[model samples]
Target chain A: MEKRTEPALSPLLLAMRGIVKTFGRSTAVDGIDLDVPERAFLTLLGPSGCGKTTVLRMIAGFETPDAGDMRLDNTPLADVPPERRPVNTVFQSYALFPHLTVNDNVAFSLKLRGGVVDIAARVRRALDAVHMADFGDRYPHQLSGGQQQRVAVARSIIAEPRLLLLDEPLSALDRKMRGHLQIELKALQRRLGIAFVYVTHDQEEAFALSDIVVVMNKGRIAQKADPQTIYSRPADSFVADFIGNSTLVEGRIRERHGDRATIATALGDVTAPAADGLAAGDAAMLVIRPELLSTRGEGVATFTGSVGNSVFQGERSMIEAEVAGVSLRFAAEAPLAAGTPVALWLDADRSFITRIAA
Target chain B: MTFRQRHLALPVAAAIVAGCLAPLAVLVAFSFYEVEDFELVPAFSFRAWGELAFSSTDWFLIGKAVLSGVATTVFTAILGYPVALALTRLAASGKGLAVIVLLTPLYTGEIVRIYAWRIVLGGEGLVNTLLQGVGLIDEPLKFLLFSPFTIALVLTYNNLPFMVLAIWVSAEMVDRRLIEAARDLGARPIDAFFRVIFPLTTPGLAAGSLTVFALSAGEMLTPSLLGGTSGSTAMALVDNLFGTAFDWPLASALALALLATLFLVASAMAGLLLRLKGARAVVGRV
Candidate 1:
């Protein structure tokens, strides 16, 4: 029922109010409101089947909302077809037309306009933007997945739409390729100054590319904030759990003062910055980020526990320590053996205490 | 030795050579042999060739066969595209039902279908009767049956299934996202069809054209029975020469000529369709 939107800083490019979409009996998008500022990089981030993509589809005019009002540049988008809308999408699959060469694929919209005198020059520039100008003659099948993805971006951007929608554009690429394209896409968004609404389940991708991140769950937005705020001060347990390698300990608030609360958990009572409106005896969760826990600290140890599991990652190891029947996960530079006695210190001042999501 | 797929094709290839090429070789020999008094002979001569080469009537009939095949192919393709694309849009279960519905007419014997068509298109048949009842016509339309129209209509109806099925299979293989991408890139529905859907399905169209062309070109019974004055086909003449007339040499020459012309036309049709960028993009990669 609450509309969660930041005050418009730049000119608003797109605004959706109370948008809802359903397929047969199951609802894909619950009533939700969203806003995109001009030249903003906004990301709809969630797990699969979280209605992020449905929202993107609604914006691209691929899926009509069942009950909602959507406007772009102060014009209602209800009657505009996808082709007529000044919007384009970079599909998740990169859906490059197989029959056309890369040059023709990028020139598709211009050709449809009939007698665009500078189509070839514009196509060259679009392809050059994606570093794919040399592949003008290549067919879609002739190119690799990443190359196809680049061509897809070139095609969508060639028309210079007012808004661009991307549905997990980098998901199909290898990890290294995904990282490369993420940097490229963010740079492209900045250079073009076109508003971008990107949908992805990868938290790191969302954080890396977006100025505003919308976390969705069960066809509704769980949280909408800047990525740093979302990471350090998650609105609820769901946002905290979904974002990073964090341990959520079930607890109840014992006292609240100003912006801090002391929550009683199985381990012990700890004071931390908490979400607003948390009174005593209210159910809450202590979000222990991996960075907040250390084996060596200046103060006295918070808990004495034994290392339960340590997975050796390339640069660091993810270590889980068992204390009071709770598996507390944290990262360590070196792998620790199981059953090794470890004394862990909790930086409760920086940890977040937030309400449990319904 | 390890067996491969090409090796498996050996026996089928042998059977075809034995069943098809050997008979063609025999026809080549028979075309040169002179027939005397309806008696068996093996003497080679140019008499049959000379007669066929000079007969304008035979040439006209052969030209008519080519035109008929091309017309039927074009008609079926024009009508089949929408049905095939519609079939692709159906749900999986609905598609199964649609396929059965499309092919249900084919389940009836061709002769039965021809008679059913006669009942629908004849002077006193369903269409004419309905038209008369509606006062659209003063007399039954004579062109309804026992005309070239009847033959073409019947041929298109009979061959529509094959064309639709071929295109439906191809259309089903096309990723739906491409069409969405086209629309997102500012292509209208009609533009998407011409620029994306139509080009991508050319391989299917080529296949369907070849099949319909072959089926309608060499057909004899349909034209002979349903095509009254316009019913004289090269096939019928060949049949007459081989059976009632007993001019085996001339019959062999005419049949071989018809086969050559049809083969050339089919090849050209296939070549033109397959040469499209869309077809090459699909088939070349595969």
Candidate 2:
């Protein structure tokens, strides 16, 4: 029951603390604490069933937290219903009111509140932002899938909510349309300066649109960081593997120095940057990106492998090889043909080592 | 052989449908013929039609009955919606049990249910005993039974299941996510129900209203039992034509007019409900 006019007092926009949602006997979102700073573009990124969408639902007040306190600014939102919350959601299904015109769909919130002033102007502006101004008269069935998605966005943004929760908004569109809308939505978010809490399993879309990417696994956060940090320096084995292409080699910590450590694996012994809580005899994964492994090198920490195949991707070539009967994948500029002898160079600086939890 | 099978099947199906309509068509045709010794004559005249059109008393009585039927239909809808809502809100297992209970009265003969109501609403019935025990009244209230109100109450109870079922079916078809979406759009729980839930279920409500209207219009059992002499319905008038007066032509005329009016009202109700349902689907698709 806080004052609605005091928007400045609660500038965080949305703060979800220790959110836990359980369906039947199983937990869908476990002990999640998330915050979206005012006007920040935050993406909840994960594979399917990782509870990213559940987190978005909790923020939008669609799902109640079993044990958590959500706040809009400094005000506790636990008791506030979804409709009363200053948050709007773009559902995965688009969920545009089928009976109303596109203009009516966008103006729905305004109509719900029984206010008539300037609805047309606001709806037009919202449609223009999404580059769908002329679609105001069209019914949803008449429009294409991409147009429906844009109309869904327009409907949400027309109300000017403090936080806009997008649940895989672009996933239903074609790839090219998805890419185009991603740029437009990003630009629109920046222009409006409204907080956008986007949820998606697509890593590329998350990386493209998010100021901060929250990677989730089994209803818990794997890592939360900027796109570059999450890509380059993932917190654990799961984060590293889930984010990008990496050669995860199982090994044991052989030695640890002040800032450097070396692990012994089936591939070879390689020195890597020191990770916290690393001890001798502890099982760890040496996460090395494909491009970090070179095709030809003779070094102290190098593996001699026969390249089985090379995939000629436009930017880089992916070489799959066997080193000591262990399959290792690496990327290089030059394509190596099948059954070719190759020496793979391992770079310690680019490789992140983390203790694997059993 | 296939053509022969089609020919046989189609004719037989058409005969079955025609068999259903033959009784009403015979009544319409009989309205133009004069009755002699309980047998209809082959010759036709405009005399019965003229009598039906000019008889102001019959028109007044039929109009009153129609007005009462409409009122009872509305009453049934109002009473049925809450029960349907409560039923829909129940757990799946509970819903199954509830549906069984709601349909129990429908399975038993209408005579049995009317008698059961008579026991409940009678002079020395459950209601009288309860009122006497509570000392709310010194005597059993005669107003409770044998009145238009009694007939309306009976008609509503008789038609309650159809209304409830119609509303429940529509209510269940509503996408739950839409309610959540409305809430996410800053609608209060009450607002969400009014804007999303109720509007979406309107087709069901309209359907229920139409069902109750049709059932109440053709109701004979309840009016004959509970409506007494003063609160007679259109069906009671038709029954009297065939019974006490033996006025076959007048009864046929009244039956035809009643059937036509019921058809028009039912069609109008269905058309309006369909338009609303279509509008809901259109809005929901996006």
Candidate 3:
């Protein structure tokens, strides 16, 4: 409701309502609604087969929604074919025209429409946007993977589409290359000031680029929020586990005190802030972010456990604590050896009590 | 290529070269030898070549062969592209069944197919009878089986499988995402086909065209058996000279001339198709 008062600030660019897509007998995208404000870097993030790519494809007009209404710039897009729609896509495989040169590939949309002023100049500008001006004479096969991807971006943006959809564009690149392109892509999106709907399963990529991240599971949106909220205050247990290393303890709510709930778990009575619509006697899951857990903290829900295993992950160590036959994984500053007595304290006030995803 | 790779291809390469070159050598030898009293005399002479150079009928037959090959190729390509593309969209099992249905006519020998065509296209054939029964025609269509139409129609029908199979394989290799990319980049379905799908499948088109051209150009029985009045071909003349006329020298000369003419035309067809940017991309030339 707050989004209605400030319509002038960031006008709606695209809105998809109650979208659903089914393939064969399996549902790829269940009923979901999404909105993108102008220039917003929104990403539909999920694991493989979770319908993130299908959603992107639907927006691009490659796949029609079985039931939904999509609007672009407040215009109904039900009858608009992909070619006529003011949207373009950067395909996962690049899909560069192998027969055409870089210049031709970038100028394709402009040339197809014809009568466009300064076609060559616009092509050059597009190529320059991706730092591929010097490679206009080369074909797709002559370029490296990252170079091909850059050309694909240049080609997709040459016509200056109102919205650009990227389907795992950096997925085919090497790890180091993916990181480099990720930063470049974020910068490009900012410069273009065009709304971008990106899809990826990589949590870090989503966090690094998206202004708003939509987490999905089994063809349904688990949570949609800014990256920080998605990380620090996940909406559910699945979102917590998917986005970061978070320990989820399943239990029944013993009592509710205004905005807080006391959950009775195997570990004992735990107190955390309750989610909306959650009440006493309801099945709840407590989300404890690994970063908030500490071995030494002042006055918190402390538990006694033995160190199980620790993995040194470059800058920090990921330690697992065994408490009452349940393994709770958390991060530690240093590597803790196995079979050592460990005193772990949970920051219960900083944690959340939310419903478990069905 | 590595030594092992080259070694692997060497045997087939030698076999192909030997298989093709040996026939050409025999034709050349026969062209230079004189036939006296039904006996081939080992006398090298330019008499047969000189006669062939001045014969308008021989040149006409050769020109007709070129025209036949080119026309059949054009017809099959225009007609086969849609069938090949449609075949690509079928399910796996459906495609297997479709291919069998596509090549079923081949299982029936050429003689059987020729007779079947006669039954379908003859003066009082099924088509004519149906047209008359429907009151669409006052009389039977006489030109249906014994004219240039019959020759062209029969040639196209006989060679369509080759065209469709070649182009279908090529069309299948074209990435479906490329079509989507084209559409996403502001191309209609037709525009996508012309710009993306057509260009990438040129190799298949070339292969099909070449195969159909060669097969239809060298065909003799279809024209003679069904063409009625316009059924004469260079191959028929070559057969007559070698068998009944006992004129191996002139026959060999005519055969060589026809072969050379068709080869030039085939090369021209290949050159035109492969020169497109789409073909070069597939073959990795550019």
**iRMS of each prediction:** 1.5, 3.1, 0.5
Poorest stretch of ten by lDDT in candidate 1 chain B: B34-43
Scanning candidate 3 chain B in windows of ten residues, the lowest lDDT window is B35-44
When 1 and 2 are scored with DockQ, the better candidate is 1
Model 3 Cα lDDT, one tens digit per residue, A157-274 = 9889999999999999999999999999999999999999999999999999999999999999999999998887777888888877788889999999998989998788988888
Error of 3 at B145 (Å): 1.2
Residue A198 miss distance in model 2 (angstroms): 1.1
RMSD versus native structure for model 3: 2.1
Judged by DockQ cut-offs, the docking class of candidate 1 is medium
- C-alpha RMSD of candidate 1: 2.5
User: Which ranges of candidate 1 are over 4 A from the true structure?
Assistant: A1-9, B1-3
lDDT of 2 by residue, A237-267 (tens): 8887887778788899999886668899887
lDDT of 1 at A35: 86
TM-score of 2: 0.91
Predicted model with the maximum lDDT: 1
Which residue pairs collide in model 1, if any?
Answer: none
**How high a TM-score does candidate 3 get?**
0.97
